[model samples]
Target chain A: MDELTAELTDLYNEHYSQLLRMAVLLVDDRSAAEDIVQDAFVRVFDSRARLRDRDRALAFLRRSVLNKSRSLLRRRQVSRKYQHRLVQREPGPDESAHGVDRTVLAEAIARLPPRQREAIVLRYYADFSEAYTAKIMKVTPGAVKAYCSRGVTRLSSLLRERV
Target chain B: MTELDTAAPRENSDERLLREGLHTLVRDVEPSPTALSRVLAKRRGRSGSRLVLGLTGVAAAATAALLLVLVLVPDRSPRPVPVGIAPDSYVVRLADGTLASAALETGEVLREFGRVDAEVTALAKGDEHVYAAVAGEGVLRVGPDGTTRRVRGVGRRAEVSAMSAANGRLAVAGGNRVTLVSGNSTRRITLDTGLVVRDLALDRSGRLALVVRDRDGGAPTLRLVPAGRAGSDRIRLFEPACAPLRIAWSSTGLLVLRPRDCAARDAVRLTTIDPRTGGRIGGGVGIRFEGPIGGAGDVRVSTDSADRVLVSTATGKTWLVDGGGVELVAEHCVVGRNCTPVPAAM
Candidate 1:
């Protein structure tokens, strides 16, 4: 109806699935990944007025999804580290799924450090420009390059080792 | 500098692999219908998000309430029972076909994707990929994430009649031959029998079962053709009464929809015959359900490759049956009848 609503619809319709995919890869849980994407849309919708160029809304959404994903990952890592009791961890969606090429790749990416995983996921998976990846990741272009190189190398070895 | 200026920055073989793999990884996965509906309803109920954002105090209070609910309350919802479905189960169907994987308990579509150019006739679910056969085109290897790679070297005129996937590979019976497609390599096995191949089924060991019509105007025959060979060691199983009883290899064994009586259109029994030895197994499954399982348009049998045997009628009725008889999974769609069943794993 309104410009904001129209823009939200377009972005959600076009990019929400992709953004959801990005989050799913970052975090292996489907429910949590959807929540992360939902959080991203809420963030974007709340700050829509500040967005001077609506064309860049997708980029903003991507950035927000990455940010939200990173936060969730951080919380997961902390919870894993500080658990007082030896609780059995529940298997996530990706872990439960057997077979399929993407399932293997997702599991491997999940094992990488957050920055390296993000670098590979953005530069290669998302096909983002290095500069744009650097902006979303909040790192220097050189750092992005290093992360991508290391991530790719690690991924190659990780997948190869599995075989 | 040129790399920086260009659209692709540091594109390489590894990047290509990453891109391809990642694209396939998330292709068919969609956000949960529950989460999506929640967001949609919120937007519709409140005209503007601006109104909510402007009221920071209200937002804070709402956030506090949400936090309180999370802390003070414990989730009591019953965990959904496992419905013998693979975690990454997916299917490929025609655009008009209902192609959404749904929650077992709720029957709400969990994930759905794929809008192909050609009509999807056959779908094969492999361990690592889902292969779809489009008529007059070629077989497409689909990743769980929805990325599709049209198989090459199989030729375009292979109008797929039946398909099966197992052990990280797929086999499509198009026309009078069956082609085994894995990665980049394809091997074709022509029947040379002068009979049209009707249906196909493959077991975990790659044993193929075919239903073919006899050129001499005799009863249609079923053939057990092994992989990588054409006619060598091929065994003709028996005559299939129903044309659609071509071949469906379930976890139990190779399943055949055997009609109860030669003339009875509505009643048929499901039997597991050994693909290696054409002998019928111990006990057969016969449903006592009363409905229109007519000879109107031939019965269609689908499986989730785990623990499901869905028999559908031409008039839009579907029955979920086990080894013995019918199980009431859902008569109509959980959402509605207009909702499509996602191929095998509905």
Candidate 2:
């Protein structure tokens, strides 16, 4: 009913699913993906005073989601080192719920180094333009192109072998 | 591959497969309905919690009506002689972030305590020297002997954010990992919780405690990582709350400054805990202040007095707290040197 709530509702209704998918593709865990997206929205709401333009809300949310996902992945990696099997229960191999052969795709993307995986997710999975991906990743368009190329090359090799 | 863009190049088969495959993998996914509601509910809860705090500021008028009460001290036997730093020397951070220790009366820098090239971000002192985290660099030790050497095995490129030292043991934390160092044997410890490192503390026996914050805006946690030699038994401790920004250690116990209402952020409770088990040691003092301190300065444990603790803030506020009470011994001044009432135990 209020202005802030009304604006957030509209944004959430429009892009919540999109952002969730983006996080899922990057992090490869449904529960972690949902937390990452919610965390991003919380941050946007908390720092609403700093954003002057209404149009940039989506852009800001996207960038925050990417950065938070990167940090979460790094933290999880470090945690798994010491705690072993207790911290990370490996998901048994299963086919995609949508029948899209996502297990292989997920494994390949996870194998890519963090930055390349991030670039690939923003460019292809989220369907952002090169310039927009650069803005979200805080790199130049050329850098985005480079990461995507390297990531795509590696992913293609891995997926091809699965056939 | 689903949702294949028709505008793709006629060549480059790898790009096509990757993009099309990604679209198919996520095309059917949707956000949970409860997710948006949870977000809205959390913000509402945060807004409703911000109530203007009423503080019982420093008891000034009560000085005339001194209601002296006998203090009941704990019966723990006197432990081994605690290590680190001479009783009279004081350590502090200048306004520009340089670390220095001085005499109690004249504010003369006895010796600078870090490398100049890399700014000192975090500092902790031992008896002979001060162990400082040089921003993006690892740990550096500076002392009365004028010897400066980088602490090995703590990753030379590590941007260490927190350092805690007592006796001969040291623990340095940045991110989720903590490097426990004693002499030449250094061990890297990764906390089981996938949380960011907010603060770190170490007792004289090399017991480590870390304050880790969740990815969300929830209350932070204080987790004591159990450390002992091979085949030695250990006890684990974990306390979750919006912990204060600083944690100190003395011969008696580990000291934690717990704020009353984290949302209001006014009054603070000074508690001493058994380092091995997170158990409270004795009756503590309550301190009410107007605002938060600027940064973590230094913590000097009292060897002579009723085991009082001296803590300094970057904004030049020094406090002395014991079983009796918490007193503002200095304002706009570091401990030992130039502090009002001249901190007697420093």
Candidate 3:
């Protein structure tokens, strides 16, 4: 295999699952998240030469996955508006009481504005620094702080009410 | 797991719950075993298709030339031809931070309107002036005679995020506040605490169409506010799937340029919506680029007197879209090289 392909393969093996998980958190749909992750990988492959190194390629992959998830949400919103339909997922057959709580929390996270949700997921779930999160989101660090603060507060209120 | 989780510090109950919940939420998610192979196969397929497409295009071009001669040379029948009416000129911030008017048909810099600091973030054109929003500085109004002056009232340190102008008025947005300026009469409208303005437009009647996002959470919405009312007295339009990167008011309707999808780069869709009711007017045109055009924030659109739209990107590319179609009019700078006078506005 070529050097670029080999490097990408290594990066994919190491980070695909993590990126996939992050996509799931961002978009909430497992299949869509998988498609987003795969598309991101394909995009990275298409732009591999410009990426130059593994680190940049990985960063590009993360950004691409995030962008794709956001796009999916935007598309879904458009679909919901024009069609006047609601996307309701039925509870799985073996879903436990814990699964219900998880669903509620996920829904709350999903409801947060796009930036706030991104900030929350990047900071708490991905454990990124405020500076790094800002870098990824292309916003100021202060903005990231504000988003995280507002997101956490809203999530707390939402989860409290659900409980 | 990645290095991200390794350096995480201890968290409070809420933070801990959030982190734990996020982890548990995706615990069962994984890519199918064939995901990697599928990607590689798709890549190969795309590469193969490119060659096929290139060959097909050559054959199609030859056939089209033959048909054109056959249909037009001997047959004197009159056929309706689509005429492309290009805008005369439009304003853009050059890579060197200079704002200039460039001819749409010739790609020539018609006139230089002076330069602002490199921190200028947004640009809008009024009836008698051009405006540039400088980061951490107020908006600078450039008159027709090339005089630049900072508009008063908006605080000096206001970090203007978006700006739009129409009729005789200008709308400047910073954080959650929008300031409307018209003939020395400036009115400020503060949005709800967490609502952030993404892009905005002003109709001929002075009505405002704002694309705003709730920082707390929810889809971004298009809202219509009356001319002189507070933001609270606004009507929420439908939340768009592809949030508009830029919006402009045309004679026909509100011109919205958005990514074809959320993950947009190569192409964008320009749609028209009824200013009063947020209903789609018609299937808009799709503007494609050679590659990604920066981010959504970097794309800007402006409508000329004839209602023709000029779309500019931070990557130094510009296109003029009219009833005929979208046409690439200028490349002020290269992508990675000398993109000095990037089109900040127009």
The models' CA-based lDDT, in order, is 0.61, 0.62, 0.72
Which order, best to worst by DockQ?
A: 3, 2, 1
User: Every model's DockQ, to 2 decimals?
Assistant: 0.11, 0.17, 0.20
Off by over 4 Å in 3: A81-100, B1-10, B49-346
In the predicted model 1, the residue pairs found to clash are A100-B128, B25-B145, B26-B145, B27-B145, B27-B146, B28-B145, B28-B146, B98-B340
Question: What is candidate 1's CAPRI-style docking category based on DockQ?
Answer: incorrect
**lDDT of model 3 at position B206:** 82
- The sequence of per-residue lDDT tens digits that candidate 2 reaches over residues B1-346 is 1222344654376666677778766666788869889988876776555322112223533543354333444557878343344443456555555456653323345555543455666666665667777766678876644467788888777867677776677788887778888889888877545566766777666676666666555556566665663221222334554455556654456667666566655556666667667656644566666685332232222321124466555445556553233445456555344422111223
Q: Write the per-residue lDDT of candidate 1 for residues B133-165, one digit (tens) a residue.
A: 666778776554556677876667777766777
Evaluated on CA atoms against the true complex, candidate 1 attains a DockQ of 0.11
For candidate 1, give the lDDT of residue A49.
60
Deviation in angstroms for A65 in model 1?
Answer: 41
Q: Rank the candidates by lDDT, best first.
A: 3, 2, 1
Tens digit per residue, CA lDDT, model 2, A1-163? 8888878888888888989988887777777889988877766776555333455788888888887787776566434431222114344464443332566676677777666788888877777777778777765566567667767887778777874
My TM-score estimates for the predictions, one after another, are 0.45, 0.43, 0.48
- Residues A15-131, candidate 1: write the lDDT tens digits: 778788888777766677788888777666555564445656666778888877767765654344412110123334544222324545666777676677788888766777778
Evaluated at residue B315, the lDDT of candidate 2 is 45
Candidate 3's residue-wise lDDT over B181-277, tens digit each?
8889899888888898888888778888787888886656677787777754343345555766778877667787878867756888888777667
